[model samples]
Target: MSQRVVLGLSGGVDSAVAAYMLKKQGYDVICVFMRNWDSQLNNDILGNPTNNDPVCSQEMDYNDAKAVADALGLELKRVDFIKEYWDHVFTYFLDEYGKGRTPNPDILCNKEIKFKAFLQYAEELDADYIATGHYARVEHRDGDDVMLRGVDGNKDQTYFLCQLNQHQLKKSLFPIGELTKPEVRQIAHDLHLPVADKKDSTGICFIGERDFREFLKNYIPAKPGKIVDYATKKVIGEHQGIMYYTIGQRRGLEIGGKGGPWFVIGKEYDQNILYVASGDSNQWLLSDEALITGVNWISSTKPEGDFDCTAKFRYRQKDNDVSIRFINEDTIYVTFKKPIKAVTPGQAAVFYDGEVCLGGGTIDKVYHNNKELEYL
Candidate 1:
């Protein structure tokens, strides 16, 4: 019998093509659609009913996934991880925001949900490996498995999966990792899959495209705060909530007649103040060093002393040259070769040695020169 592999069919063009590739490669492919959220319980931030609508987009995704499975003559399995997501991912998301920090829930979803929850469930099916549509690659290097960036640099998703360890990398397969986005879409189109023309999903994994502020208001109560101009330390406008804004944000400030556009520079959570600076290139927004915590080294061993590598503080950002020094087991201090802007706390600072993902951790503190930000 051929080796069995469980493929996560997310009702997207990328996953549809991944399923086809896995099946063609002689693996006994079983499609599994993971339902990580229940829209019935959704409400606006203000506790108002989201209102009755037609079938939720998730249900439509399931329908499309089923169609793709049927078209490919594969058996589709459905699994629910709503509870797991709430406990492992959503709680952390709320906690980080509550602390006035910006967290990337997509990165947590990959670490705690797809790799952890989904991998365990795949094991229950007696499968040899589990596959997904993520644009990243897993390779056996030396005596261990290594996670590498996908061939399509623009769509490489290795950053999100930076928390994954060697064990998860060993059991995971990214069939579309070697193909470009357009190539995957072309394959899906050629195969006549229903999701071939479907648009790519963005934003948080399960949340889809919605009013972010309105969605967040449901979990974290909005507290009106003062928006202060950093240059003059004068209150320019009132903000809905300090947590709703992030460093380097330019829109929705509503502070006009200031002679220039305003950019968020810092936040004083205790004082409930949001600091803004005029002009796109504000020196206050730049940080030369940062303290990172909760580091997970993919190789299960920490690199010694100071080392040079390229790092990315946010997704889709060009990697910047930096030097990292270990502060302890779970913490490190990084100094960038060039000062970068908006190095927000609670976001991951992923390090890379060429294409190999070296793992990362949440940014805890940002420093400008030798001094820490006043608000932090």
Candidate 2:
């Protein structure tokens, strides 16, 4: 009998192609459509698709996943993770935002919703392994297991997946890690999958299909604020609210005095003050080292001593060389070889060594010995 691999089909080209590849490799495949959110959230008129930005085509997505599974000649199962998402992801998102901290809910969603839920579901179905379309590699490191980056540098998703513990990586399978996004699309095209041309999913998972602010409006009550340059204390613009904005944002600021270009430097939640500054100010916006807290080592043994590796502080950030020094059981200090721009708080800083994912943690604070941004 062939090994059976239960796959998570997310109604996208990547997951569809993953199903095909696993079947072709002689694994007895069963594709599962993870219903992380209920459809009623979309069909409800008050919570209509137009009202919320994240609630896109749930019916279409569920159908697409089902159709792909049928076409691949596999049994399809749907698991509802609504309760888990609410308890773990949504609560964290709202709490972090409430505290003026920008949390990466996607990371929490992966940790609490998809992998954790799907793995349990797969075990109940007597499967050998659970698989998904993430662009990261999982390998046996020295007898223990670890995850690494994908072969395609441009589309690597290990950053979002850094929170996975050793046990999770031990059983996870990322079918598209060895291939690039274009290559995965090609595979889907070759397989004649329905989602061959389907656009990749973006933004916070399961909060689909709503204008971000409009969707957020339902959750977080808005508060308007003034945009001022911290250096000059001159009110150059007015913002919708500090909650809607993010660090390093350039557009929609509505600032004048275009001496250069102003970007979001920081926000003062208590005072309702949004700080704007020239985009080119390295001293105010950039930093070399940051203290990352809540570290998770996918390996059983945490790395000790000064270790050199590449890390990404936020999603879409290019890899940069860094020296990571373990500070304690729960923290580490990462010194970038060169100053990295906008090392934002409440983001994950994932370290890597080629395809092997070292580990990662939450960014808590940035520091410069004598001359640092006084406000931060």
Candidate 3:
């Protein structure tokens, strides 16, 4: 039997082009646009206040995907995964922020929601494999599947795909892994797809539009608090809420003090306190050692003993040269060659060796016991 491929169409150029390419590959192609977010919330963000479209309608997106699906003469499937999305992604985002932890909801969304949910959905439909517009590469090593950064370095999304396991990677497909963004757009245009040049998706993972601050404020109320200098412990200004802010934030602070502009280095969730420290000093919020928990090792187990690897503490950050030690079953102690700034407590530290992504987990704490507080 021929391989059956199910591609997720976002009514965008990437996915449209992806479907076209898959069909050209001689595989059985089926386009599935998972309606993950509510349409009422998204249309409002797109400035469609009237919002005639029902929640999670994806009417416009579906139309664009359908055109590509029909052009390729393939089947199309529309699956509503809103309940799963809310339980897995949206709720996780809110709960993290509620606790003053800046969680990467996209990472969770991919690991638990889209890839896992859609993979199961496809299997139920008797599909052979699941494909998407994700700009990452997949490989098999030691009979275990692995996810890696894409060939197009600028658009590489291995950061978001780090959480996927061996099973998901084995059954996954990334059609645009080798093409640049422009090349993708060109392919879409050549195919005469309606979303040949659709604007790239940004901000939150699924929801296309909506003010993040305003939307977050709905669930997590803005509790007023003082912005204090971590060095002086002097209260300089006020902040709406500590939960709304994260490490390395400068704007919307509404605070100005001596020693140049300050950035948010930390937050006090219990007291509704906000910590402001100067970026001029390298030591303000920077630290060397980090404790990572909730690890998901892709394809295999952790490396034996301490070894050299590049660890990225935040999204879009270049991998840092580091050494690691397994602290426990799920926790690891990672120390960077140089101090990495703003080691936010809630962000994940993804470990990599060249293009191969090992695994990553949420940062539990940032410690600096090796340094001296006497210097400050």
User: Which digits, one per residue and each the tens of the lDDT, describe model 2 over residues 123-146?
Assistant: 898988899988888885657887
Q: Pick the candidate with the highest TM-score.
A: 1
**Local error of candidate 3 at residue 266 (angstroms):** 0.9
Residue 326 error for model 3, in Å? Answer: 1.6
- Clashes in candidate 3: how many? 1
Listed per candidate, the RMSD to the true structure in angstroms reads 2.2, 2.8, 4.0
Model 1 lDDT at residue 363? 92
Q: In model 3, what lDDT does residue 15 have?
A: 80
TM-score quality measure for candidate 1: 0.95
**Per-residue lDDT of 176-229 in model 1, one digit per residue for the tens?**
999999999889888889999999998678767777787777677799999898
TM-score comparison, 1 vs 2, better candidate: 1
Candidate 2 or 3, higher lDDT? Answer: 2
lDDT accuracy of residue 50 in candidate 1: 58
Shift of residue 70 alpha carbon in model 3, Å: 2.3
Ranking by TM-score, best first?
1, 2, 3
lDDT of 2: 0.80
